[model samples]
Target: MTGTHPVGTRAPGPAGQWLRNLTTPPRGAGEPPVRLLCFPHAAGGASAFRPWRGLLPPECDLWAVQYPGHEDRVGEPPATDLTRTARQAAIAAQWLADRPYLVFGHSMGALLAYETCRRLDHLGVTVPDRLFVSGSPPPHRVAAAPADTDSVPHRMHGYEHRTGTETGAGPDNEQHDEQYDDLAAKTLSADLRMLAGYRPGPAWRVPWPVTVIRAAQDPDLDAAAAAAWQDYAVDDVTLATVSGDHFVCFTRPHDTVRLITGAVRR
Candidate 1:
C-alpha cells in the first residue's frame, strides 16, 4: 500500500469563515489552475479517488466529493436520492468554483456530475469547461444501463478530512474485511435503490464537450449505451477506452489523470 502524500490546508470561505457547512476547498498540491472536481461511484467515497492525487499534475487541484454518509461523512446519513445528492454537490461545486474548473465523474458519479453541471447552469454559475464521463451512460439511458456493485473494492480506508487529506492505508483493512463488507453491502444496496429510482426528466442536455472514458475490460459497459452519450452533448462526445474494469478511474488512475490534465490544460 502506498503511504500518504502531504495535502494543502482548508482555506476559509470567500467571506473568511471556515467552510464548516458545504463550503469545501480543493485538495491537491498548490493553488488551482483549473480544479478537477471528482465525484465517486456507487458505494464509493473520496478515498476512492485518493490514488489520483499523486498521479495528478501540480497545476490542477482535486476535490474528491465525500458523499454524505460515505467514509468520513458516514455518520451524517446516506443520500439515496439522486436529485437531492446532486443539488448538494452543486452547492459544493459553487462554493469551490473560484476559477475555471473541469468535472470528472465515474459510474454513479457521472450522473451526479452531470446533474451538478445542469444545476450550475440553472444557478447562473459558471459550468465546467468540459465534462468527463467515465464508464457511465448519459442520464436518459440510466434506467436501462446496468449497475456495477464491485467497483474499486469498496475503499475501506477512513476519509481523513483533517485539513482535507486522504490518509489511513494499511493492512488493517484486511482485518476488518467482514465489517467493511457489511458497511459496503448496506451502502451499495442503498445506491442501487437510488439508481433504480433515478429519472432524468425531459430537457436534460450537456452543452459542453463530453469525453466518455471507458474501461477496456468492463463487462457492465454496453457499447451501444456508451455510444448513446453522444446524443446528449451539443458540443462533442469523445470516447476514451483505457485499462481496467468498471472502476478504471481508481484501478488505472494514470489513464484518467492524463486525460483530465490534457483537457484541463489544453
Candidate 2:
C-alpha cells in the first residue's frame, strides 16, 4: 500500500501499501509477459538498466530494482542487511504475481539479487524462472571485507573512476561541497559495510537455473571463483566472459544486452 512504483506511476505510502504496490510489476499491453527484474550494483540505481528495455524481446517485461541512499531516494538510508534488503525487494516484486520471471544483477547487485530470490523462497513466493549473476563472485565465495572504514572515501573516489556529474557529482565540482561529501561518505561507508559484512555458505540452494557472467578483463574476478556457481544452481549453470572490466554491463551495454537477451531467449 505504501511503496513507490518502479516507473513513477504511483506515489509511495506506508508499510502495508508499500508492500502491496512493491509486489506489482509494471504492465504493458499484451498477454502475460515474462518479467526480467534487474538489480543494480553498489551505489547504483534502477536507472542503470533503463537502456535494456530496448534490447530485450517484447515478451520480456523489464523491471529495474531501485535502492535507497541514491538518486531520488537520497533521503532514505541504505539498508545494510541482506535479509532486510531482500525482504523489501520480494515484497515490491510481489506485484508481478505468479508470472514467469527472470532475475539478473551485477556486482554487489548480484549477491543482493540472489539473496532476494532466496527470500522469495522462504516466503513461499513464486521464484524467478532464471537468475543471471554478473561480475560477482558466488555468494559463498565472497569472504567478509576487512574491518576498515577509514579508507572508504578514497575507495569510493577510486571506484567512481570519475569526478563529474555522470559520476554522481553536481555542477561546479559539487562533490567538493561539504554537505555532499558528508552525505556521500556516510552512504558509501554504510553500503561498503553491508558489503563487507555479508556472509554466505554452500547451504543455500536455488531450484532454478543460474547464469554466471564475468568480464574477461575484470581483475577483481577470478575465473575459478566464477566457476563456483555450479555448487548452488539446481538446474543448468552457464559461464560467460565478455570484453570489458567489472562494470562492463553498463560500460558495454550493447554486448551486455546481447548476453542477457540471448540468455532470456534460451
TM-score of each model, in listed order: 0.80, 0.79
Clashing residue pair totals per candidate (backbone < 3 A): 0, 12
Please list the residue runs of candidate 1 whose C-alpha ends up more than 4 Å from where it truly belongs after superposition.
1-32, 145-174
Candidate with top TM-score is 1
Q: Tens-digit lDDT track for model 1 on 40-144?
A: 787776666667767767666666676666665565667778988887777667876777888888888888888888898888887787899887877877776
Cα lDDT tens digits, model 2, 59-109, are 777777767666456657777786578778777777654687788888778
Tell me the whole-model lDDT of each prediction, alpha carbons only. 0.67, 0.67
Candidate 2, number of clashes: 12
